[model samples]
Every structure is written in structure tokens, then in C-alpha cells.
Target: MNTFFHIWKYPILLALLTMFGLLAALIGTGVWHVLSWITLTIPAIVCIRFGMFPKNK
Candidate 1:
């Protein structure tokens, strides 16, 4: 339902960005590999989601 997507937006956006970064890295673009590596980790996104937006009850 709608609720699920709202709760999982972070994971979804992370996955999409990860895919884009990987593709950019594979294409041999400068600086993309560095960004790709960053997106692949969890720490980068943890604060972005929970820190900025506390979940509502």
C-alpha cells in the first residue's frame, strides 16, 4: 500500500542512486567511481533519512 512506499523511500532512492553510480563508474567517468563507492555504503544514507525526518506515529 501507500504506507509501505513511504516507509521504504530511502532504500528505494538508495538503490536507484547506487545503480546510477555503478553505471557511471563502469563507464570510466572521472570522480564517478568515488561517488559510486560512497553510495554503496549504509552510513551515508542513515543520517539522511532518520536524522532529517523522524518517523511519525
Candidate 2:
């Protein structure tokens, strides 16, 4: 259970962020759009960070 949570944590967070961003963009204006952009960019930033500087194992 602990291992499962540990492994799935970031992915779940990213997925939730993506969902919120999409919903925010679809359902509102002004500040919501900005919020959506920020939320949406977080996952992309995480991906780019991991992709560009992976851990050496």
C-alpha cells in the first residue's frame, strides 16, 4: 500500500491538475483562464524536467 501510493502520487497529482485546468478553461473566463494555464503548465514542466534531467541509475 505504501509503495503503491509512493509510485502513483505524482502521476495522480498531474492527472488531477490536467483535469482541473481543462475544466477551468472550459467553464470560466479571465482569472479562470489564467488559473487553467498555470495548472496545465505544471504537468508539462514536470515532464520536461524529468525528460531533460533524468536520474542516473
Candidate 3:
């Protein structure tokens, strides 16, 4: 786990941040309205699974 984070932390952070930023920036536009919430499920689930809970050792 430590090794993984040490090597991929930056890239993971960048990718997730970019995805979230793009998602947030589209709010209110026509396409945004179209995908407005459907696309949100990915990040929402990611956060819930990783950010909110971790498996026991």
C-alpha cells in the first residue's frame, strides 16, 4: 500500500481531480443537464467506497 501510494499518488490525484473538475465545470449547460446526475454515480460511488470506508486487515 505504501509503495503503491508512493509511486502512483500524484497521478491518481491528478486524474481524479481532473475528472471531478470536468464534471463540476459542466453544470448548467445542455449536455451537463443531460449527463448532470448520471455521470455523478462514478465519483459518488468511488468516494463512498474508498473515502468513507476501508476493508479490515
Candidate 4:
């Protein structure tokens, strides 16, 4: 994780996601639908992995 940020940084990823989302919204077609679906899943997976995990109690 550290190495990834060190090399590329978060803003790059954010920009890419934002661009894809904008493209998806403006052009709601076949390939764009698939691309946006795959792109949006990133946040869903992150939320499940980091927020919805079972914690030791």
C-alpha cells in the first residue's frame, strides 16, 4: 500500500475514477456501462473490506 502511494499517489486514482464516472454519465452505452460498472465496484469492495469486516470483540 505504502509503495503504491509512494509511486503513483491517490490523486491519480481519484482523477481516473472521476473521469470514468463522467464519461459513463455523459455516454450511457454498452462499453461505457461495463467500464463504469467495473470502475464503481472499486469503492464498493473497499467499503466492504475496510468498513464491513468482522472485528474481534
Candidate 5:
């Protein structure tokens, strides 16, 4: 149980889950292009918002 929780910890798990959701939306769509774009863009925005790239201080 501890190992399972460790594997599903935040950051990695969140990113992985978002990636899976995006892939699912892309591959499993019929008229949900907007939703797919939103899903993909949200993670990117989150990364950017949280300073994914380190800045020189």
C-alpha cells in the first residue's frame, strides 16, 4: 500500500493522469475537439504558471 501510494504521488501522478486524459480525448473523440484542446492546454498552462522553466535569480 505504501509503495502504491508512493508510485501515485503528486506531480508525477498528476502529470501522468493529465497526459492520459489528453491522449484519451485525442484518440476517443467524435466532436470533442474543443475539449481535447482544453485538456491538453490546461496542463501546459499549469506548468507555465508554476514556472516549469527555471529562471535566473
Candidate 6:
């Protein structure tokens, strides 16, 4: 259980954030758009960071 959480925690969190961002963009009005952008940007930034500078192993 510990190992599972250790490996899956960030992925799960990012997935949830991405879902929220999508829903916010679809269903929300003013402030929600900004919120959606912020939430969505987090995962994109993570991906870009990893893609550009992956750990060498």
C-alpha cells in the first residue's frame, strides 16, 4: 500500500486536477476559466519539465 501510494500519488493528483480543469472550463463562467487554466497548466508544466530534462538512468 505504501509503495503504491508513493508511486501513484502525484499521478492521481494530476489526473484529478486535469478533470477539474476540464469541468471548470466546460461548466464555469468568469473566475472558473482562470481556475481551469491554472489547474491545467500544472500538469502541462510537469510534462514539459520531464520531457525536456528527464533524469538519466
The local distance difference test score of each candidate is 0.75, 0.96, 0.64, 0.74, 0.69, 0.96
- Global local distance difference test of model 2: 0.96
TM-score quality measure for candidate 2: 0.91
Query: Which candidate tops TM-score?
Result: 2
> Which scores higher on lDDT, 4 or 6?
6
**Candidate 6 residue pairs in backbone clash:** none
Candidate achieving higher lDDT, 1 or 5:
1
Quality of model 4 by C-alpha lDDT: 0.74
In model 5, how large is the Cα lDDT of residue 34? 58
Least well predicted 10-residue stretch by lDDT in candidate 6: 48-57
Model 4 agreement with the true structure over 1-57: per-residue lDDT tens digits: 588777776557856886786689569888888888787777667668768785565
- Candidate with the greatest lDDT versus the true structure: 6
TM-score, per-candidate, Cα-based? 0.51, 0.91, 0.42, 0.56, 0.44, 0.90
Off by over 4 Å in 3: 28-57
Model 3 clash pairs are none
lDDT of 6 by residue, 1-57 (tens): 699998999999999999999999899789999999999999999999999999786
Q: On a 0 to 1 TM-score scale, where does candidate 4 land against the true structure?
A: 0.56
- Clash count per candidate: 0, 0, 0, 0, 0, 0
Give candidates' CA RMSD values in order: 4.3, 1.3, 4.8, 4.6, 5.0, 1.5
Q: Flag clash pairs in model 2.
A: none
lDDT of 5 by residue, 1-57 (tens): 698677667667567757766776767776465566765676777679678766575
Candidate 2 Cα outliers beyond 4 Å, as residue runs: none
- What would the per-residue lDDT of candidate 1 be over residues 1-57, giving only the tens digit for each residue? 699998988778877877877686898766877877776655466768778998786
Candidates ranked, most accurate by lDDT first: 6, 2, 1, 4, 5, 3
Between prediction 1 and prediction 6, the one with superior lDDT is 6
